[model samples]
Target: MFRYLASASAMALMTNGPVFAQEHDHDHEDVTLYRVFVGDHADAKVTAFDLTEPDRRWTFDTTGQSKLYAVDNGSAVVAVQSNDDAVHFFTSGISLHAHGDHADIEVTEPAAIDQSLTGPRPFHVIDHDGKVVINFDRGGYAEIIDGHELSHGELESTQLKQARAHHGYAAPIGDLWVTSVASDAPVEGDAAPSRVGLQAINADGAPAGDVATCTGIHGEAFSGAFLATGCDEGVLTVSDGSDGPIMKMLEYPDDLPTGESTGTLLGSKSMQVFLGNYGAKGLVVIDPVDEPHFRYVELPFRRVDFVLDAANARFGYVLTEDGSLHQLDLLNAEVTKSAKITEPYSMDGDWNDPRPRLAMAGDEIVMSDPNAGLVRRISSESLEEVGTVEVEGQPYNIAVAGGSGVDHGAEADEHEHEAHDHAHSHDHDSKIYQGYFDDAQIAERQLSDWAGDWQSVYPLLQDGVLDPVMEHKAENGDQSAEEYRAYYEIGYKTDIDRITIEGDAVTFYQAGKPLAAQYASDGFEVLTYAKGNRGVRFIFEKTGGDEAAPRFIQFSDHAIAPQDAGHYHLYWGDDRAALLEEVTNWPTYYPSSLDGAQIVKEMIAH
Candidate 1:
């Protein structure tokens, strides 16, 4: 079967037809699956669709119009209906598991978990470590639920209560809960209690530290080791300390203009940077660890909305009132690219008015255009319009789940953790594999095992003529056809179109130009994946060859014994250690005897 590429661990069990096989029907393989969830602007409904089959949609009703949040590492989504005082959970039905060398994917139908949480004004939802916290602004308490239990359809929560009801926020930080504080007294006719500062509390609802001064604290985000809360005066940062949670006030720089403070913040998952709004036409990049902490960036126009690329941490996307989507470089603090996306969305209307929202779906950026009643997909690398998904009502908020992972058959068993230790420990050693497999039929082999001429299948995929094969894989596997194509597009790119393996000699052909080398056995490495399955990589080092030839090459074709390879993924580089670290790009090849149509038939039949 076709394979998918991405990252993560499996959270739930889902069984289906035969294990995803290419030639060997019993051997399991990886596949990519991405899900997009959109909440309607005026209707009490949410719509979901896989990136592969956008035409096939799934809909669910809520108590009221809601805002969606992708929590629990994309396994589930939390829909918070503040006005209705209700929260709902739905599993995206896409789970990814990381084997030491690759990831496995499982895709199921998206459905509600049949659970709900109701409180007075359920507002901000925060997910940290393995916990999800829903702060009820009027209830004056935050509900903390284990992310694991949540994916399993449970609604139990440990309430972290405050002194009184207020428009506040709370998040799980290490072993303590960092919660916003309310004032002692409330003015007459006020909607809620006034927020004064922030305080840390234990898991048992007891105080862990004194309240830190943060007048009118609101926005909060986690970046690296720090959790920042936005304040009128500045930004309050909290991190784990040797003794307890440490709080620090990062006041606005002296050079920054007055009357401007961050009220909305977005944090990076890979870097220690925080991107926050600094008034209507400017942005602030907060470096929580270094000096000269606040770096301000001027915008082209008033910003409508902005989102960070969690997968690729160096960039962000900002939608301005000009109906333009601008790519922001977090590392350089500048606008790197821009493209007009929709009709101008003025910021003059009510703050809650429907507008465009941005979300990252794999390598593409998905934006909700409420006015157009469509969800637009933009290429992150090119910032160009690629495609669009139409919706009946205005599409307002969107949250994406699903990634790439291998799907071991229903009968597959969990791999021993010692396999991971073995892979890591033998990084520098020439021989890594040491009888990790229990089957007598699977054993180490010689260089003569897979000696033959091979051709690459990348050109066929690039021409977009393999839809039938993709559709077949989609029918048997859980994901859509387009998803499988996208997966191969990334995993099968290569300059060398042909390869010939004979005895101890290997020849790589680039445009009919051959670079041949003699290789010696360098042992094999066994890797444990997210599911209880494992894969093996046969290693070889160049003994005599042209200088242009790579010093090392590893071949993985779902085989470990002395047998011929029907097809294989090849990783070649000069650095033996770094080549093992590379997982995203694996140039694949098949027998030269197979023609284009035959290859597609082979894939479909497999």
Candidate 2:
């Protein structure tokens, strides 16, 4: 059985027609099954596999040679749209169409036309809540296709267009999409564009007559209560919704000296939002709900583009031109963390160089690493390295399956722990404080002040908490799940470290001794800066719950362990990593002292 790993070769081979068998190493009723539907940068071929299962492989080449990007609308079906003006549907069912049949090749149905749209140059396609929406740039129009199978095999499209042609999008509701249309007159040069706005289009192509226009409106996002619109002057705030879905344009509000911004990102967690840099080197957050002022949040590097953390809901990731995934915090709108992804794709070249694009498949995030030729998985929760898999030539888009078929049993178990514990903590008498801290963070912030990054990134942080000891457990059995280089292990009891065994879990560093116990999984790096020695370590601890006896958390610091090691961590980062592990509902914050003990005890009593 083949498990996806992170590497250059893996990225190169991500899109091809070959089924594979992947192993499952868990004690459960079912097996780990996954099928990744990948589209190439150059080739018109579409790759499919049971990402979780990896037991078989499938491939379907698009009828027309168009660049394809896909979004999973649940089940094993994917909605794919290429540069060409059409949307295709591909399924992973074993039944095969004739080899000569490009349209019939394993297709449950024929290709769906973007009838709602008039002009070509198809832009983007998104499947929100089973509604398939297609965007056309040539003509400022969008079409919607429902995911449900109708009695007839023919596919239908719904039309929704703006008054003028401009570049924009449809709001989340799938009804009213925010878009841009052509200006009234021509510009100084061929560079066209006049005004942009939030146009409410009904299901049948008709503008609601109410348009909240922004001069340079480009990108936007809408929650039920508020809508963030990006433009030149600043974020245009429109809180005056007569009723129904509120619409407002938040002009560029950050204090940057660059040009203008249209790329606006909205977080699902704290209602915070982000705006890409004017020229691409900067980003900012405008929390109109909290701080109405446009705040310029600096970034480590300028981004080619950025993606919202759908699974994580709180944080988002940016793929820089330098080939790195910088972890972003939407609540605060800042670059919180970063990790290298590839050896850097040539930015000096053309716009369509088959560079890696960032996408989330379940909790696993797949980046098309052209130089690395591999797609790696970063723990959405821990934001640490977990595992990776190889793919073919410049994987442009990735559509994952089976994760829906079988929710990450292990990953879900981890989330269940937080959900149940969170409710329990709220009821607990604990003072309700922030959770844990990193080495650099520990110096400036107290352990009890873990909020945004500290809490959501590591569930140990929250609004209110009592005497709380946020501990993580990891274990290693004879058969390890992923194989890679370097790992972390729970080692000996040192003068500063205390190791205790309470049942199956080997609790280490009770009072925060390791400085940063971030890597609580097998074979992690310590990153000893003062000493400047890079090595590796191995550790194994068991889960601390009754539901499953062998549950544990391990740590492998690259500086202290051997290379070629890997493990699955999905509970902490941005919930985009593919390392879906088996999880259980356990306590996230365990009381080890009196401060929050009474609260927890009170919660336990109920």
Every candidate's CA RMSD:
10.7, 18.3
Q: Tens digits of per-residue lDDT for model 2 on 139-160?
A: 6676665533310223456667
Q: In candidate 1, residue 286 scores what lDDT?
A: 85
Cα deviation of 166, candidate 2, in Å: 4.1
TM-scores vs. true structure, each candidate: 0.67, 0.53
Runs of candidate 1 with Cα error greater than 4 angstroms are 1-26, 99-101, 411-606
Report the Cα lDDT for candidate 2: 0.40
Model 2 lowest lDDT segment of ten: 96-105
Off by over 4 Å in 2: 1-34, 52-55, 63-73, 76-82, 91-119, 150-154, 172-179, 186-195, 222-224, 236-245, 264-278, 361-363, 380-385, 401-606
Specify the highest-TM-score model's number: 1
Candidate 1 per-residue lDDT over residues 29-89, each given as its tens digit: 6465678999998999999997768987899999988899987667688999999999999
